[model samples]
Target: MKLVDVGGRTMAYHRAGAGPALVFLHGGWSDGRAWGPQLAGLSDGFDVIAWDAPGCGGSDDPPREMTMADYADAVAALVAELGVEAAHLCGISWGGGLALAVWQHHPELVRSLILVGAYAGWKGSLPPEEVEARVRRLLAEAERPPAEWMDAYLPTFFAGAPPAGSLELVRSMMLDSRPGGLVPMLTAFADADLNAVLPTIAVPTLLLWGEHDDRSPVGTVAQALRSAIPAAELVVLPGVGHEVNLEAPEAFTTEVRRFLQAAGATLIRVSRATCALCGQQAASEDVPLTWMTSVEDGRKRLYCDRCARENVRSIEGKLDPVYW
Candidate 1:
């Protein structure tokens, strides 16, 4: 366990594993501890870090007012404090939104991103009233029997079938959640809009969705995000739901491992194309053109202050010495 003081609040985080850094962000109605299965499964091959959001588990609440960016900043601070220049990020449900927010604000710090049952905005095709009603009902009956809620709520998150023991574990995590944390988090969810920021994320992203996710359905939202982000890959789990990570840990972990491995390898290749001025790689189609521009010659023109002062460097000059 470690503590990171960000925004005047002490955030609690648990760390495990011994390889490449990987951070897991839990969804609403759950704390970092909810990732027990994943932490155990992946710890052998990766450095796993999971933290409790403000007002959840061992973390202190944020000041009276807080925004999604605040949460994203907190994560950035934690990543920096850990001395990690970049890491593979995974977020579930509400945490998925936070992960996207983090990537939007600090793409350079993320090696790869995974979003499970996440949304870009709150204003989807579902009517506001219907959305509110479902949320209200879930919150209202959260304290009741585990089996009952599982029977009712589990379907909305998974696909054609639920995994064994998933219902019980999810029920326990929900019941243990802090209402104080859940309420504010839910309020934030109601107002979240990553549509504008989505295009800005340059890191490789894997968008995972359960075929039957009612809260944030897969088809339209997932398709729209895939279209919006140039480097995003979408995967639909056949018999899963909103809590696909929890329901099918093996499948989810496998997909995440594959994506991270590929992203890491690509990062190695791009590192050799470092810009003379900023010491960062030349922007490629796989990466966003944050400080560069695409010219009419079907090539990415370098726009680094140092490189630009000397005139935009041609790709032909840089291509001779391929890094990979």
Candidate 2:
């Protein structure tokens, strides 16, 4: 863990490897340590940094009145302090909202964006009633013992039972979350509405989602994001849930790497086409395979027209076509 003072607030972060900078911003309930897998896995290829935002992990509690813009400026200060010219910001959930805030406030510092189980903002993606309910729940949960609430709440973040130790790791982080920090950190997002900011994004943006994400359901939230961000690509991890990074770390990391590489490429040229779901080959030169760029590897994925139409809803929902 590294410590830096940005505007009198001591922000903490973890860094590893060396290459183009990749910064990870965790969700409301999590701190920088939640990105352990990403920091370690992507270290060999990039300079990965994960920060514990104000009120989370080793960072100090923020003022009750702290705004998302304040958080964005804090991120910019940290990046400037680290001497990085630009970076790819990858954020999940509330962190995703912060990433949008950063892009809005500090566009020049961002090279690209990767948002997982993300939202434009609570107001931008969720219905007004749902947003109120979620904020109310967060307020209630902030005062309850971590164990009592997490037992029932945490399951909603995963597709099924979490792998052994996964739940424990998240539980420990939630346990460490202070109400002083958590309340402010969460409420800031509750009041945010970045719908206007979405259309202004000029950087390469990738939207990753868990097919069964109950909190930020792919069909509603992810699609709203995709339709708003011009040319943003969406990839749905099958059988995954809201905690896309934790539930499918390898896939999450791979997709990030692939998106970064593609974003940096001078030109995109396809050599062959095959259905990512059915493994069927495209038969003719004129046949167009529906594009699905972020598969496990670097190959460009395309679904046959037959498969595409049959599973159009799933594809639009960004689910693994296999499920269709």
Candidate 1, 1-324: lDDT as tens digits: 578776577888888998999999888767887677788888999999998888777888765466788788788888787888668899988888888878766655576788888877454324578658756875775456534554465556556554677666667766666556766676666667787666545557889988777777777777787777656789998777788887788888888888877877553223223442455765453432223323433333324456554645344333222231
Residue pairs in candidate 1 whose N, alpha carbon or C atoms collide under 3 angstroms: 157-241, 157-242, 158-240, 158-241, 159-240
In model 1, which range of ten residues has the least summed lDDT? 315-324
Which residue ranges in model 2 land beyond 4 Å of their true spot?
266-324
Best by lDDT: 2
CA lDDT, every prediction? 0.70, 0.81
* TM-score for each model: 0.76, 0.81
Candidate with the greatest TM-score versus the true structure = 2
Q: RMSD of each candidate?
A: 7.2, 12.4
